[model samples]
Target: MLWLVPLFLLALRAVQAWSPTDSYAPGNVSCADDISLVREASGLSPNETAWLEKRDAYTKQALREFLDGATANFSNSSLVDSLWSADKIPRVAMAFSGGGYRAMLSGAGMISAFDNRTNGSTEHGLGGLLQGATYLAGLSGGNWLVGSLAWNNWTSVQHVIDTRGKDDELWDISNSIVNPGGINILSSASRWDQISDAVEAKQDAGFNTSLADVWGRALAYNFFPTLSKGGDGYTWSTLRDADVFKNGEMPFPISVADGRYPGTQIVDLNSTLFEFNPFEMGSWDPSLNAFTDVKYLGTNARNGTPVTKGQCVAGFDNTGFVIGTSSTLFNQFLLQLNTTSVSSFLKGIIGDFLKDLSEDYDDIAIYNPNPFRETEFVESNYTKGIVNSENLFLVDGGEDGENIPFVPLIQKERDVDVIFALDNSADTDEYWPAGLSLISTYERQFGAQGKDIAFPYVPDFDTFINEGLNQKPVFFGCDASNTTGLSYTPPLIVYMPNNRQSYNSNTSTFKMSYSSSQRMKMFQNGFEAVTRNNLTDDSSFRGCVACAVLRRKQESQNMTLPQECAKCFQDYCWNGKISNKTAKVSTIENYSGSISFITDSASADAASSTAAASSSGTSTSKKNAAASLPSSNSLKWYVAFASLLGMAIGLM
Candidate 1:
């Protein structure tokens, strides 16, 4: 019965909620509306700066309300008022990592934990912190989470969770993208027809089309099920007109991508990183050092203006297309063609397209009529090829090893004081993170790519595992004075890697489909991991989060850390310890592990005792592996199966 759901939905339809339209296709348009649409990437855009002015008041109040809940643990209760009254205020940011659906679902759970709007999130969790954040950045799969939330009128993650299991609801990943059919209950063939029509429209309009268009179209069906044509008519630039965004009720959302040339197989640290915000799309890297209007993305421009007088292009930057560009690395789906249930005719069409795509590069999002062609800027290794190119090639943001979207938040103009980096990367053989992404990002700061940016010192990946930094929340960039040879002070990084808590959440990134139970378990595990078992393991986690946010503001004012917060920093901050041993989780208890608040000791004891009893009676192969490493044959099978699937699908 469960297996039939996909086919049933594909064959039947109750509503014609959408129809094919050329709204997403590029078109020639007038450019005389505004002269200030494009500008140099010298600093924050006027629109963002003005929006921040309004958001500042919102964050101040949010921080106050959040800190008030934790006042019992604070030595200085009045500090919040003092900090808000001062000229400098604590600015916060949250960055979600890339790992396809794993990242999206895990990040969504963490978002729910951070949002005070979610019921019960404030009990023993770091709730209300999302409201205090100034910037939200995502790359690849991470983009899907933030983009979905931002575009859906800034909806709460709880709302999405509540809609699960219903037909054509958001986050109903019952069917894989390769066989996508939902919302309108069209057959897989029908869905492919719609996707083909959209991409063909872009191509027919005299613009380049790639697999990214198809990928984004598939993603749209899951993310925007209620919208017309599943959001085909929607554009990412339209977020600029949303009331929530214009009123500064939500944090600014940014999606990140990396630039690549045709036929380049490897993306290194020196690759230019570009960001797509509501106002514009561009890079802060010194090479191009410019930005242009995101609404008129297809317009051929030189020196920050359209090449043709009083003429430009519009509707080229579709919402799905923009999100897909950040995750073009997912084109590996072609490699798994035989594994999927896609129809033979559709397979042939995709196969033909992949043949042409592989000649250059399969993983790329094509942007014809380069907006920065011949733009006057400093000529460097990165700029010369970009300015001369007639087309722009963008790829996955994490293709360069920076899985986390930290580059945008660390900019000097943004003035972010702290960053909560949610890392769900599977860097180890067992699908656990080994802190390799952070190491890559740290190494990047010393290269030419780190022109105006500075990153805090980070140890090798070996130290990350040997010291258990990947298993819990660890603080980086704590001591500002220690960071030398940099143009600006880096934000304090609250690195929280996904780990086992109430549930083992080390699901493989390529595992696209999940049962409803698996989805809910992952969400629960994410909340437990972020709150560290609802502060049962360490009650000071909430206080520590507050302290991390207040670190830079206090240091700027030359204030000492609070008594409890000082102890928290000492336990959580890495103390320059290094080890040559191979990567492994540490067993050391950094803090006093105590469940002092006996809210329900009887139930807690019952849970542990029952779990142990169940484990002894059940086969080890089927039981949840609470420990880090895989010990059962079933898990090994999962690893092998996921590896094959990963090669076949290669999702973000």
Candidate 2:
């Protein structure tokens, strides 16, 4: 009888979470299930400021152990010790880029290198590095890494990996979203119906929903696979209460999305980069220099002020939705309903439902009533720039190709001293990053609005690979004083691009599916790339890391450069040389980044798949990442049909 749960759930609308927007918030008032905590404007909320105070205590302890030992070999043995004072100590930030699952697992392995908990992570490894940091940021696939850890109580990535099957297989890559791989008791039909209805509820609440809503729901099913019904009641803001996050036991998790003007084909570095932090969701960029409380995201606000005109809505920032919003490019999966395993009836419903939006089908997460409605960022007030008027259209972070996660790290206020950027973008013919992400940010910094924020000068793309800068670890902004393009000191960046040393972790950016073995191998490869295989391949990598970390303190104090650091800069830093000549563009041919330790045939299959696609093309060569969708209310039947069709999907 209990096994009949799936069929029973499909038969009814099902008593579920969330009131529809119509009933939740009708003509005159806002959502009835309004959360009391309305949207407010402020800098790092008192809550975050307070949490940082406590977390800094832990960070101070972590850095004392790490920096002192890592930098002991330098001429200034006491630099880490001497700069132990609160403000002077180097503030570090680790940023992960977007590249689907490759970015997530690879970032996981690299992050694992900084975790003492991972086996052999501490020996010659920067294990305590994560603990000493102030911020952790991710975009797209990287969001999965940061979001997973935060939602799971700030657990180690290794712990996340170890507890797969035993704990409902949270990161179990074995189960595709459409097919659960038998991890849960619910049938595929029940899962689809429930997610579809929840999305429909949002639509019913006077919001326009798209395939992205479905895409986000499907992603929620995978990232938060442990929930009773695929994380039904889980909200992103709920993370605020997690003891670890609230207490600041971990790095602040910041997930990013690119704000697309409705119907825009692509994004540039100047395109507003929006972030969803535990406390709020907004862009620090002046384009929309305001952020609302994360819990009150759906509350219709006018130009950064919450108007009593609209009611506040809660639980709209579902954890899955946030992560899904960051990676909305994955919505391409839903658009391919023709080939998807879903039934044709559901397919036609989705097709008909999306037909109007299909004309301008940009895979984006719509934040309704425009939080930044009248602001300069929302050019809706201007008739010329926008093809359609919509508030808060967010797409993949790398949609602009500024994939290094620098937007959140380089904040003048965050004052991060050095950023360890894990570059997992597929920017070259070989599918390995060739410093293009860095180049984009550098170019953006030249604009009138962005000029105040100084970025390290990087060589042209051809120079990035020609000089072997992309092949090995490189340092940018090494000399803070001598740099040309800045009003202030930008953080030194330790750029570690995905390479083929341990495993060619440069899987295709479009690739979503990966076998467990390939996934683990990618993680291992990332670990080795970060630690240089625990410093075996390049023992100097460790010493260079210590040098990069201490450079800021050395600069602030006007201390002379150490001989070791001098050598590091000469060998690893870009020397203002330009090479615009067309690059021969590097490629990894027939590369097998296979892990022999795992015997799963699934991994072997995935390895063959990865190698086959390695030479095809990179994300840079693809169509615009910010493709638009239609949300026009031209079809009245869509709302009615979707309301019923969504629930009736499983039966057909």
Candidate 3:
């Protein structure tokens, strides 16, 4: 009887006819009734119906903005304040070339002007004012228009060059934005001084200077100093401790095998610079004589090997070091060390000036002169960039004669709305957990703020238990479908607050009979379901299934919608699964594909015992490895994920 109530309400709406004026009447036709009918008609969940609605609203809003000529704007003062409040910080921008020079001047001038206008009470710098302007431009289309015009005018006058020359230096100059050598020499020098000073200061403060210290400081200082000091001090340790070793004596060199050269070069850890014995085969050989091999005297001499030494030859300007019988290792090590030190110094100086604008402005806003929070602005812009970058853009294949860059015309932001119609068939119960996990992980990584509601399938058993018995049921739909023979037919509908839905169907294609708004509601509902569902358990396959279904639906709809709609949908649904089997297989693969082993070890009692054992083992291992070299596992997993996702999406 409880299950039939929604069904009955839907039935009434389906049969009843109303005039245009009466269509808006809440009592006459409500989302509750509409969703109930959808559940009865399509066998999806009420949550899914709600998802579809929210999706539709977003799609519509996007279309409207596009059609009405509006631009998206983002702001947050908290993030900006936080960034500014940091003790050590990187420089945001480096003045390079004519355009960069002009921009810097403009930024500084604008800040000064703003300060004067505000009675010189603001603590913000020139970069902050520019950031504010950029933020405003991002929010308003008018600013973009003006900016474009200004850019064009500036480029026209400053970058004019003949395109016919084989050695067109103009292109070379223009490309200097991304090129290292083309940067302005004066600016580079200034940045280097700034970085060197900062590093020296840190060293004086007795901070734990390491490779990370150097790199992180470089990033914060946004400067690269010249390497006036000799030796190959470009190694991570040296760079990190650049401040510490400012006036310190160079360490003795050690002999390094040829095979380890690549690793040494990559991490700047060449033994030629900091090894204890430059000519010795290993780290140190105390028995080695400074001039010649000493006469045998004690047992320590017998055990100790002679340290290799180099002497001046007849025609050579300086004496060359020799290791064992070969001078090759000794000579090469010295050369590498000398080159690396100078190179790193130059790199540090240059890198500081070219710092990204966002980093600089983020720090500035942290001190509280803005209306919005700093974190909000950073998150919004970062997410927006991610979304924009993920969108599809067309390119010429080069094989064809057609060599034009023409993007697909997507629907305007205001015109089209998206609805996520999910398939919540019995098969979904197996793979929904993966989808849930993905949502949870993404939310944790990116910060959850604008996500829509999710629609899930509500079975008759839960409805009956909750409504008929007036008691909450532990198992919502455990008895509704027989797990042994799960079927794809008769999809259930659940309404969520947002317009998103997840559908699980056996067929490759399924009919969606809901209106545009209803479709969005379905997607939102599915999104919510996946978001709320616990993914710690192995059975959380529901989320993955929903994600796949929603992706497919979005893709299909993208084909018929405007370019922006397609782009947005494609970006969100990128790497989405097309089949239930694929979703299930992916989830299983993630768990190592051996369900039996995982399940056996994952049992409640077994898990507790195993956890205790692992903890004990870990403690012992940590103690033993405390003095040894660091392991690669310390790198964050999110960095790896971001890299992989970036590569995949970039290629796509």
Candidate 4:
């Protein structure tokens, strides 16, 4: 009788509702007769160059506030102002790594700490750094965080936090993607119906669809619930049309994907890295150094010209699809359709369609009418079967092992001085990063695929963990003199790895869901990680960040590093030590970070334990580390269910 309620509601709703409409299908657009959409990837596009001019003015106040807050401990802080007044402003970029929802929630907290709008951020955290930043890059789950902010007109993290589980609000991950009803049974059925219809509509329009499409649609329900058809009409290219973006109130956003050929099983480090920004979608890698108007993506082109005279296609760069392309790793989720509790009707639609696609490469996103087909400039340095093919296949950006989205920031044309690399990769069995992504990017610099790109030198994985590089924040490329054989020096890397914090944030990367309390704890841990527990770990952490941002500019201006800045560099920057010892496990499955809030029963237990440890003469740092054991009282039932689900997923 209880099970009959869902079937009855679903049947009644199917009769009452029409399929949700979305901009999933490609449509014709007026291309202004002779306008060419595709162009050579020679340098920064004119659109980006012009946008930077607008951003320069906008960042002035933000940078000022940031610098003021950063250099509070310095005696000769006036020198910093003089340097800035002399047109030596720092150019900062932040890249977020991919690790499913863990990255999204943790990255959200990092952004919140860097954001001026988050309460207490300006006073006690690294607020205004996000505003001062010139660019933001993300891939996979990180792209979810970036897209959520950009699509919502650059909304604050506080806004997202405030509206967690309200009806139609985003971040309602209680039911996971497989069953996204949360507390409402009706919304779950309606959502699955919408996802099935959206994918079918794309297929009916002669486009190739895959599990990535299904994955993206489910992602939208959690990230864009308030928008029409869950933001189905939203296209990534349309971000430029937003007033806030046009006014340069937000940093330029970039999402990344990796090109794969038909039947390719693995994407290696040499694979072409494609980036999607508001203006263009392309790669700067030598294999296919070309870009096309992202809005006109579905149009056929040859040698940078339209294949059909005076005709072009639009609405092909659907926001969900573009993000889906970057996060194709999640296509594995859809592959588990038979195991999920999804209605047989919706499962049939997805299962039937996926059976036709390559089971070995279900992660691929098919871009038919390949925009670069027969393009001579792209063919000149072609790799494998890309140029002559009529379809383009792209997969997860992190598939190549460069999970942190640093490729875009290191491009010489961007002139970025430093990048804050927020790593949340699941590189270990226990799900923690060990600087492998940085190593991959560094090794790419010596290959032909690297071409004009330069990345900071990083040591092997053994040294990364043995030297504690993967746990706390460390600076790479602190000295330009260490890097050679590149046309230009790479931006300094501010590596901030997701280590044990106020919570054991190393939940499995495939853990698809989080209770509200668990999610908030992850966010709090991320915020604490970035702020170094609001500088409790080191009062000089903020000053060190400022020094990193100003490192290149100060060198270029022939000015010496400030005394305080030099000391900060000595303390936080890696000193080029190598280790022969084998790497040990990096994940500590306990709360070891400073406890700020006690929202759940786990937190309450942590607080009680910390009190006991304090009386027993435990050290302060150890107490903080041992206090975080995360679980929610309100969600104890789900926690038990999720534990079983997690174990099952692990076995599978």
Candidate 5:
């Protein structure tokens, strides 16, 4: 008889892909190299800037093709010139937020709408946006989207869907991370040992191991498929070698994390923000603004040379560990590690380890021989940690609520002209982007000690929700003159919040696994939100995207604005307004309702009732209650249980 998986709540794998052929082999991607380089303390790496030069050429060509399709029947030669010109071309970026799998799949859907690779995405869709984009960044679960596509040589989202379930590869979450599902038929007992052994080996080799390492191995089973590709190992740095990434065929991938000091849940605006690309692991944030050779992570170096730990360590920044570092919110599962489901004897063994981990490494990555330890630029707030053990602890990117990886994208050095930030955050009790991410980012950009980055104006959360700005698309920094305080014109931000007209894509971030059908609906809902249901709701959606692209170029060239673009700016730009008072979702026929999309549609009346139920009790108890109150930024347990039971896992 087939085994029926036990019902459990919490603990989720954000991105899923792949498995190998009949038998599992060693690994595919190669790790480590013979080269060494000088680590720079300031500015973009020479390597990345050189790569961006080549990448810009690819995107410009792609954008010219997109513009031809968008403006085929138009008569404006000047507009076409700016759109198609090598110099006047707009630099575009796409950012994904972290909300577990919801962030991953919803992000995938948004990309599908922007990508030419998806069927019908180009015609009357935003498909060409991906090709036009130079940078792709993700936070928490969002990195799952970036990593999955990059690992496959930058394959299309459709391809990820097509290959899944054919042999239980690429999104077979039927087996929880706690259980082995792919080609490895080992029972949960064997798999647990396998994970523990791997981590132990790393520790045995004189490297420090933490819960993040264990979490990485658990999450990698679904997304990291190279274990059987026959090589030393697969890692995030290995992507620099893939032909697609190396040839500049794919947008540069950035993974984000916040440096967290021990014994604190508070992630202040001044906290060190770190980013990981294939070439380096560092931060653009003013505090310790520097990058280290990601390939030489475990090496003991003095100003970038091997010293104390003479032998450099390869595979230290494991691809899975790096991705897991950005999404450790699910490490709450460790609390469930000692549950009775396994065995009393094994439970006792792990329960001991859990106690020790709770003291210091609570769901965070531990980077030893921290590249910034002895560097001159190391700020005092960050110096203490390195002083103790030369360790750097990094946590989930969204810990400070800047769920979209905007730090790197906004770096003036990158010269990004526009950022299409995908906000799939569970900002409300119903799970939608409430513009909190934007608010946090804005405050930090202009806040005390945060003077380096430039950000456009974002209204209070009250204004964001009350004005219906969170329910649809809006643009910030539409005019270059507005950011007069910055050294350079900040990139225009096209904020796209999640909405539900088709699929209820606002699933809780804590709900761990999802079935193929539910996952596909998320992809569809994401596509609808980005296209506004293919102009079925707002006909101006595509035009607005084009206008955001054209805004900067228009200012730079002092070109007469197109009438359509002028209207787009007037409609989407956030006028300087502050409102501490909150608002409701736009009830305009185009938008479904102000209620949580996760709540079923009983009618407008039922939405209010459900919202009430949420505040009176928990979301699980709100099916019969009135409307729910807006929740705090932290993940809600009620949403978690309700989501786990209602979809994916059929607990009932």
Candidate 6:
């Protein structure tokens, strides 16, 4: 999108060699013969011929130099490079502003190239001609060639002819040269003002005027060509003119008053390359008419005053009364007067509304790089039902909305137990510290209590997901490490609980039931904070680590959790230093709520002592109850049953 100045210069040079005259003109020959042919034309006057000849010579020399590559010497690569530099990115903002302005003019029928001259006088309207020239200059680089010729300047000969005096004998002849009975130019300054206001309004909205706006304005103009022909000299009279206003063509007779007409019909001129569409004002409703206030144009005009036929003073503001008109000329004026300065000023008041929109788009892209993966999530939402269960809990960490709690589904009722399974695969470098900062965050959030949290750094997903499934709230840190004789592969399954099943395990089904909303909220709060911290440290592994954590949670849902107290008790037996007597007592208490079932007196005595000791350290016991639970293994049926029972009671 960034164009170098040298490229623009080259394009400009190439465009200069293009035909200066209209390409549609009868021309089967080169530029050299074209001027002579025009001079020999029967209609052109002597002065017109002379002026055309001089202009032709100048253009020919310019074209020759451009074609010969002489313009290349003027191409400024240094300026282009400077503009393209990092510090000069602001220049793009400027170009965009200019482009916006040009589009506004194009939307207005005023984009046409025309020569205006006072009647019965030699003074030409050089200002209008200069404006047209500037427009043509802006249309270089094939911009005009490709149906974008919004405006162009009249030739010098056309200017002279258009300025000829009406009383002079040559006046009619001059008018024939300028108007040519094709396009009629209405001679009224008041009509021009109405058109100008309408065009200005359209420009404010950043919309381009179509051919309809021009045709509508032209139709309006032909109705009342002069102030003497209509009441109040309003522009709307021309629009209501019955004689000249037609749907398909210009109905009026073209004369010296109209200026050189471009085409035989309105459609012909509209179809030409320089054709511009004025903005359509559309219909105004009576109900919405009350909403019109001081901001309306021409608000200060006389009460009940009619500007022209079918147009009247509706309201007024500080600038002027708002004139309601059916003509598109009003719309065209609105389009042109809508300046970028006002737009920018309004934007300053409103702030950059698009900034947040752009940021949101970026966030979406960053979070969802793979469309297939996103689709998979969507499908999971419908079929699996796990994504729906992950709920978002807003935690108050007291840092003024900074703190977040990240608890896995397995440990939803307790503290997080994260096991970082670091991948030391062949693709990973040994220098990369694995999951150290992640461990630190857990500690920072949970303090010394976090030490009980589990982190099993593994080199592969098989061990991390299968062996580490039961380790609730586990985190894994892995990379391709040649030192560990591991190869890189995805999905890495990095963060997982020791009790959760592997993604590829046939017998090991996942058990957690967290929902996508919950996961998103959890990730938004937890991982986002972690990523922010990592960002400060210039860490590049946050994305990978965050993704692994999400995947682990997802996989855990498919694996089943211990359904019975006995299974839970056994699962946690090896996780702590509990005596066998205490374990038996806890299991029995969980299931039957008494020790009467124990047949042996010594067993009962041991159970009583163990209960006494646990009650004495009730606070520590409460903390260790969930923390001391070992990862679940299906092999130990009896122990698993006891552990499950113990876990059930512990949870209560």
If both were scored by lDDT, which would come out higher, candidate 1 or candidate 4? 4
lDDT of 6 by residue, 83-123 (tens): 22322211000000011111111111111111122221112
Q: What ranking emerges by lDDT with the best candidate at the front?
A: 4, 1, 5, 2, 6, 3
RMSD, candidate 4, Å = 13.6
Candidate 5 local distance difference test against the native = 0.65
- Give each model's whole-structure lDDT: 0.71, 0.65, 0.19, 0.72, 0.65, 0.19
Model 1 lDDT on a 0 to 1 scale: 0.71
Q: What is the lDDT of residue 186 in candidate 5?
A: 50
Candidate 6 residue runs with Cα over 4 Å from true position: 1-60, 63-163, 166-329, 332-652
Q: What would the TM-score be for candidate 5 when compared with the true structure?
A: 0.79
For 504-574, candidate 1 gives per-residue lDDT tens digits of 78776656766677778878777777888877898878888888888888888887667888788898987
Count of backbone collisions within predicted model 6: 123
Lowest-lDDT window of 10 residues in candidate 5? Answer: 3-12
Better by lDDT, candidate 3 or 2: 2
Q: Worst 10-residue stretch by lDDT in candidate 6? A: 90-99
**What does candidate 2's lDDT look like per residue over 26-122, in tens digits?**
1232544433332333356666678778778888888777766676677766555566643577788998988777788888898999887787776
CA lDDT, candidate 1, residue 511: 64
Candidate 2 residue runs with Cα over 4 Å from true position:
1-45, 85-87, 182-186, 303-311, 330-358, 375-390, 448-451, 560-562, 586-652
Those runs of model 3 whose alpha carbons end farther than 4 Å from true positions after fitting are: 1-67, 70-197, 220-440, 443-652
Clash totals, every prediction: 1, 16, 147, 4, 18, 123
Who wins the lDDT comparison? 4
Tens digit of per-residue lDDT, candidate 3, span 1-652: 2423432343233222211112111111122211111001112233323333443333233322222221111121122222223311111111100011111122122222212122221222111111111001100011111121121111111111122122321112221211112236554344334434433443343221212222222222111111211011121112112221121111111111111111111111111111111111111111111111111100011112211122110100000111111111111212122222234553353234212211121101010011111112123332222112211111101001000000000001111112211112111222211222112111111112112112112222122222221110011111122211222211111111111123321110011022223323332233233222222221222222222222222332332222333333232222211121112122212221011111112232342233223323321100111111222232233122322222222221
Ten-residue segment with the worst summed lDDT in candidate 3? 401-410
